[model samples]
Target: MTVALMWEARAADGRGAELLAWVRRQDLAPAPLRRETFRAPQDRVLVITWWDAPYDAALPELPDPPAESVTRAVHRWRFEAVTDH
Candidate 1:
């Protein structure tokens, strides 16, 4: 079954762009990665990654990085492919 991983994070005060660039540099060879941003009243960012397979099966491991140092909050979601739909 294919899964889509949705990640939402808030960057530190003035480092949103920098953090985003860093994320784009990560090696996502086998799986594909796509990102988008939303402009709400309160500046917020959203990144959606589509994986042909489950996270543990196809996604690459991330390098050492401090969570609190870069993001304020994070969320992940997994979904099954809509084969019949």
Candidate 2:
């Protein structure tokens, strides 16, 4: 089975680019089968990583970005993936 890790953050005003760059440099432990990022309105950043593991398996996570770049605390979520195709 594959598990997905979802990480999200809201950047402080005018800091979305910096926040996105910081997150882009992060290393994913155990290596993900796939990964992607998205930018949303209101300076939001979303990162999704798909790992080759059981739904209940433990996975590495990206650390929080610098305080100066974010408006609020970061949020994280884990999901057991269903069929992708």
Candidate 3:
């Protein structure tokens, strides 16, 4: 089975670059099979990590950034791949 974890956050005013840099510096002990990052117009940063594990298996996820770096709590979601694409 394959699972994808999504994490999104909106940075504090004028701190988008800082937030993105912070996310880039994070390291996962047991890295995911694949990982990607993106940014949006509203100073939002998104990270998605793919893992070769069951949907309900324990997985490592990125932790929240420092309080002052974000406007609010981060958002996260998990999905299990249903196709071989």
Q: In candidate 3, what are the lDDT values of residues 1-85, reduced to their tens digit?
A: 9899999999999999999999999988699999999999889999999999999989999999999999999999999989656
- Sort by TM-score, best first: 3, 2, 1
Task: Assess each prediction's global lDDT (C-alpha) against the native.
Answer: 0.55, 0.91, 0.96
Tell me the lDDT of candidate 2.
Answer: 0.91
Clashes of each: 0, 0, 0
Per-candidate TM-score against the hidden true structure? 0.58, 0.91, 0.96
Off by over 4 Å in 1: 33-43, 54-58, 61-65, 83-85
- When summed lDDT is taken over every stretch of 10 residues in candidate 1, the lowest stretch is 35-44
Choose the strongest candidate by lDDT.
3
TM-score for candidate 3 = 0.96
lDDT of 2 by residue, 1-85 (tens): 8888999999999999988898999988678999999999999999999988888887899898989889989999999868768
Candidate 1 residues 14-69, lDDT tens each?
76665566655666556565544343323344555566665466565334334643
Q: Is candidate 1 or candidate 3 better by lDDT?
A: 3
Question: Whole-model lDDT, candidate 3?
Answer: 0.96
Query: Candidate 1 local accuracy as lDDT?
Result: 0.55
